[model samples]
Target chain A: MKEQLYGLITGILFGFLLQRAQVVRYDKQLGALRLCDMTIVKFMPSTILVGMLGVYLLLDLGLAKLSIKATVRKNMGSGLNIQQGRFSLQSQP
Target chain B: MKTILDKGWSPYLAGALSGIILILSVWFTGKYFGASTTFVRSAGLIEKMLNAPRISKMDYFVKKVPKIDWQWMFVVGILIGAVLASASSRIFRWKALPDMWEARFGHSRVKRGMVAFIGGVVAIFGARLAGG
Candidate 1:
């Protein structure tokens, strides 16, 4: 019961934020692709920086437990075949 | 030199709000919110429904995309918010201004949309296949 309530509240808040930030706008997205306006690009580095710090803090406090863990960045090509393996970690030889 | 950003909230506000969305999507859906992935999944579903033989052959189209169709309501909220912001700021006019696309490849909104769609498909497929 507690988990469900947490989810509902969290989803609503997230949705509200996405809408407010213009992240959901087609033009802003397309603009990012074209590099006409890179607010989104600027937004990412800072977002990641903050996220890294927050995650560090959480981990240090033993509060943030990530489930289904894997760290990788995929430079997928498109919608047809969803590829995510461009960059990955491998067992050291 | 005021810009669109000058009119919007501070970066701290935007970033914090976005972080909240990220945290919540993970908590509630057991999934991270990524709009592009869904777009690819949607295309695959459409192609399947149409029995397009080529779709299944593609490296990216074979796998199923995640779902939350009703989640579209969340998207609607986003649209409403953007509209409200633009209107209130009196920046509601659609600017058909020349963009990098127009400069590089000439103008055609249809073409641009198609490129974006194709790009989206390839991007999602690559990311997933690559284990992203």
Candidate 2:
């Protein structure tokens, strides 16, 4: 239930940002596909950079822990690779 | 207030806000924010309504049970937020066709709809294939 509520609020903020960025606009999408505009190009990288910085900062501050899955899952067919992060609940002292 | 009421925001601003949201999502849920899988789960849910046995028989469905889960509600929230954003910006409207599409495709609703549907299918297929 708590997770669901978090998902809802997070999605709302995401959707609002998408619309405000105008990436949801048909013109923007088509333009990006045609390589005629850089709206998405600008938006995506900025988002990713900020997200990365924020996440890493949280990690550095011991506010968040990295949950790394195994490199291979036979049932899932694909897996994530976490190269260096501590993939456990233990916090840095 | 003016920025909020504007039809559009600078991509940087919106993108940064999105990043913050992503941070929050990860911090709280220990999961990256993504919507592609939501659509896949929704298809499973819809299919489940019609044919429960077939759904159960499917290996993928067995792994990913179709139900109204967190992601589903997240999608619902997305719809609501989109509506709110459009409404707040005073850009909300009901139109069968977008002006850009009409101009390029000459207002053929059928063509637009078909192309859009196909695009959606291809996009989702790619997203799922890449394990969104």
Candidate 3:
């Protein structure tokens, strides 16, 4: 219960920041994809830098343990199967 | 200081705050921020309602174990927060087609919906394959 509540609060802050940054806007996303806008590019790097620093600091201090999910791929052929789409549930490695 | 009533904020400021939120999220919960998995779990939850046996047999479902966990609540919170933020900024409105999309792609609701749906599917599929 406590953990769930914390998740909610954290998501709220995240959503708030996303909105305030205007990266959630359709134009901003489209522009970023088209390589015509630097808003998302700028926002993401700053976030990544800070997040990396903070997370590393915590890890170095032994306050948090890193949990990395391994990449798994299964049942995928060498060639792309358009009919099956790029991703398949059966594909895991 | 930008108030809540402001339409938008500096990306740098918002990004910094988001990073702090990310840090705090990890420090307190020992978890990282991710939104895509919530969607996959949601699909699993819905599928479980319709096909319980199939869900059990699926490899991904077995590993993920779809449930309304903390991340799910976090996603719900994200929606609520977005609504609150937009309302506070007095920019909340109902529109099936946004102005920018319409201006670029024209006002064909069907076209817009179809494209958006396809895009969403592709994005979600990629996100899922990449494990969110």
Best by lDDT: 3
Give the least accurate 10-residue stretch of model 1 chain A, judged by summed lDDT. A72-81
Candidate 2 lDDT over residue span B1-132, tens digit each = 765656488898899888888888878787677778788788998999899999999999888788767788788888888888888787888898888788877978899889999999999999878676
lDDT of 3 by residue, A1-93 (tens): 888899899888888788878888888898999999889998998899999999999999998887665543332442346436646645755
Candidate 1: tens digits of C-alpha lDDT, residues A16-64: 4444565545656778888886767766665666655655566577656
Q: Lowest-scoring 10 consecutive residues by lDDT in candidate 3 chain A?
A: A71-80
Alpha-carbon runs more than 4 Å astray in model 1: A1-38, A53-64, A67-93, B1-7, B24-31, B44-66, B69-81, B94-98, B103-105
Each model's lDDT: 0.56, 0.82, 0.84
Q: Provide interface RMSD per model, one decimal.
A: 4.8, 1.7, 1.0
Native A-B contact fraction in model 2: 0.69
Candidate rank order under TM-score: 3, 2, 1
Q: Comparing to the true complex, what docking class would candidate 1 get? A: incorrect
Residue-level lDDT tens digits of model 1 in B1-132: 347543465545776666655654544454443444445556677777787677768676655433334333344444555566666555566744346567787878888788878987787778776555
- What docking grade applies to model 3? medium
User: TM-scores for all candidates?
Assistant: 0.53, 0.82, 0.85
